[model samples]
Target: MNAEIIGIGSELLLGQIVNTDAQFISEQLSTLGIDVFWHTVVGDNRKRIMEALRLAADRSDIIITTGGLGPTMDDLSKETMAEFLGMELEIHEPSLNRIQSYFTTMGREMTDNNKKQALFPKEAIVLKNDNGTAPGAIIEKNDRIHIILPGPPSELQPMFVNEVKPYLAGKTVDEIYSRVLRIFGVGESSVEAKIKDLLQKQSNPTIAPLAGAGEVKMRITAKAASRQEAEKMIVPVQKDIESRLGNAVYGYDDDPMEMIVIKSLREKEMYLALAESCTGGHVTDLITNIPGASDVLLESCVTYSNEAKVKRLGVSEDTLKKYGAVSSQTAYEMAEGIRKISGADIGAAITGIAGPGGATRQKPVGLIYLSLSSYGGTETKELHLSGNRLRIKEAAALHLLNWLRLSLE
Candidate 1:
């Protein structure tokens, strides 16, 4: 079924609050073979809401709304939608009782305006809200379906998943499934050029490309009468694409590069330590972002200054004086020293002259050295990354983990 998600709040339009509810609903609806063609955000204005309802009803089979179910004067979603649909608003007795009992159990006096939460369209099915006071609704009018959910993500997501999804399941005629394969080493254009032939002739499963940072994501979606058929249709296509790309595909879905490194480290029972100069502990931040990483991460030292490098990570004074702190020898020494001091299986260091500040004719800005040291060998790689300091730092950090993931594997 074709669908549209409407977020009802002025805060969304002002950028004061994000309408994450629409994104969450769209993803859930897509899994049920529902195509979400539009996402509309409207303020708490009766005229605008009526216009949105008219537009959604004309094009979409299902119209889902989130927000403006609170007990306040600005909450006008129910009143406006009732008038637009030409449906009378009636008190849903069960929803009223749920709201009333909640206030009584909390030992708070219930105001008359709070009863507004129980108001629903006549003959509408009430969807129970276990986490909040607002009771959601699902009204089926002829060929169209209208759903109203709470605005809070905690309340809205679970209510939709548990109560509303089952109600829509019986009416669905097909099921759609999608998987995203994330690849590194290849640009988005290059990846698309390699698979343009298959993408052009696509019918059952649609292929789309999205680029971010240093990775490209290829989303493959298939629709069918049954879940098994939908998955079966995409499997061959996924395998064929993987065979063409080989080892460049780093992850699937939403996996991060640090998670890949942590997985390999824990599997091999190896410990890692890092010394940061240019990246300013960003590499450590990425590694520690994963849960249960304390088991493998030994220590991380941020030696931003020459004195800090010499004092903390034991960079030799002569090396600092001769080749400078951003040189390959200093990076090699930093990595080796950290690994030796922390007694870790591996040590990595990032040191560079990140733009706009320190630049010379000999060693210009954006020149970075990434070094890795282990019991077997020690190696350093140089990169000249462009952009501002923060950008160069983030790129260097990600590049460090990606290299480690590939090398350790």
Candidate 2:
């Protein structure tokens, strides 16, 4: 079924609040094989809201609305919905008692205006609000379904999960499922070029590629009667994409580079150490963010200067003088030094010039050098990145983690 989301709020238009409800609802609806066609954002004005509702009813089979459900004078969702659908607003006695009891337990006065929250369209299904005072409603009228939810995400998310999901599940036959494949080291254009054929001839399972900071995400969505069947349909397509992309595909859904590195280390019973320069403690911070990292992360040293590199990671002054700090030789020395000092199974180092300031005639900005030292051998890579200081640092950290993940695999 096709759906449309109408957000009723002035705060959203003014940029005072973000409408995360539409995104959440769209994702949830897609899983039930429902397609979200349009997202409409209207102010608290009644005329615009009514217009949006009328347009949505004509085009969409289902209309979901958020916001404007409260005790305040600005709240107008229920009144508009009841008028448009030609339903009488009746007091839901159970919801009224719940609101009254809530005020009684809190030792607060229950004003007459608070009773407004308990009113719903006659014959409409009441959606209980466990988290707040405003309850939601679901009304099916004249071949269209209208669901009204509160603005607060805390209330809307739970009410949808507990009440709306099951109601919608009964109305649909097929289910939609999606898997995300995370890639690094390759630009978005390159990855898209490799999968252009899949995108052109797509039907059942669709491929969508999104690019972000130093990484790309490929979302593979399929529809079937069951989750297992949907996933089975996605298997061959995913395999073909992976085969074309090769090692550039680092991780999967919700698995960033750091998590992949930590999982590999823990699974292989290995320990790792870090020596960072231009990235400061960013690499170390990313690694330690994952749980159970302490067992595998032995030590992390930030050797910013020549003295610190010599004192902490044992980089010789001669190498720094000959090839400078951001060099392959220095990177290799730093990696080997950290591994020897911490006695870890693996040692990774990142030394770069990520900046708007630090640049000589030979070494320009965004020149990065990364190295990894393990039992097998030591490998080094150089990167000439572009962007602000923070972006360059983020890229360097991602590169270091990707290298570690590739080596472990």
Candidate 3:
């Protein structure tokens, strides 16, 4: 069924609040094999909301709305929907009891306006909101389904997941499941070219590439009778793409490079230290975000200046004088120095000119030197990236993690 999401609030139109409900609801609907056609946002005015409802009803089979279910004057969603659907608002006894109990439990007196939250359309399916006083409802009229939910995500998310998901799942037969392969160190065009055959020939399970900052993600989605069956269908396609992309494919789904590196380090019983120059300890931040990283991560030293590099990481003064700070020689020295100081099993370092500024005749902007020192030996790589300063820094940090991931392998 085709659906449309309507967000009701003057605050949303005024940019006072964000409409995160539409995104969450659309994802859930796609999983249930429902297509969302449009997202409409309307202010709290009754006329505008009714117009949006009329437009949605004329085109979409399913209309889901968030906001306007509160006790205040501008909260008009439930009443407007009732008026549009030619239904009377009836008090739900259970909802009223729950609201009264909430007030009683909090040791507060129930105001008369709070009664509005307990009212639902006659014959509508009441959606219980355990997180708030606003009880949502689903109304079916003239072959159109209108599901009204609370505005606050804290209330809407759980109500939709616990109550709305099951209800919508029952209407749909097929389930849509997707698996994403996250890749780094390859441009979107290169990754797409490698999997060009898979893209053209895909029918049941479709391959779509999503590109971001310094990474490409291939999402393979399949629809089947069951989630297990859908996942089973995705396995062969996933394997084919992974085989084509090889080590450029770092992790799958939601696993970031940092998570993969930390897991790998833990498995190998290895400890690591970082000497960051341009990335400014971002690599260390990402690693420490994972719990229990203290056992594997020894320390992070940010040597932003040439003097700091010489003093803190023991980078050679002669190397900096001859080769400059952004050179591979300095990166190697920094890694080895950190390894010696921290006594870690592995040491990684990043030095670069992440610039809108600092570009020499030989050393240009986005020229990054990454180094790793291990029991085997010290290795260094030179990279020339292109982007703004923040993007260059982010890319450099991600490259450092990817290098760690490869080393752990």
Ranking by TM-score: 1, 3, 2
Better of 2 and 3 by TM-score: 3
The TM-score of candidate 2 is 0.89
Per-residue CA lDDT of model 3 for 138-168, tens digit only, reads 9888988899999999999999999888998
Ranking by lDDT: 2, 3, 1
- The C-alpha RMSD of each candidate to the native structure, in angstroms, is 2.3, 2.7, 2.6
Q: Single out the weakest 10-residue window by summed lDDT for candidate 1.
A: 245-254
State candidate 1's TM-score: 0.92
- The pairs that clash in candidate 2 are none
TM-score of each: 0.92, 0.89, 0.90
For model 3, the local distance difference test gives 0.93
| Model 3 lDDT at residue 140 | 84
Q: Residues 197-288, candidate 2, lDDT per residue (tens digit)? A: 99999998999999988899999999999989999999999999999999998888888899999999999999999999999999999999
Task: Please list all clashing residue pairs in model 3, or write none if there are none.
Answer: none
Instruction: Flag the better candidate by lDDT, 1 or 3.
Output: 3
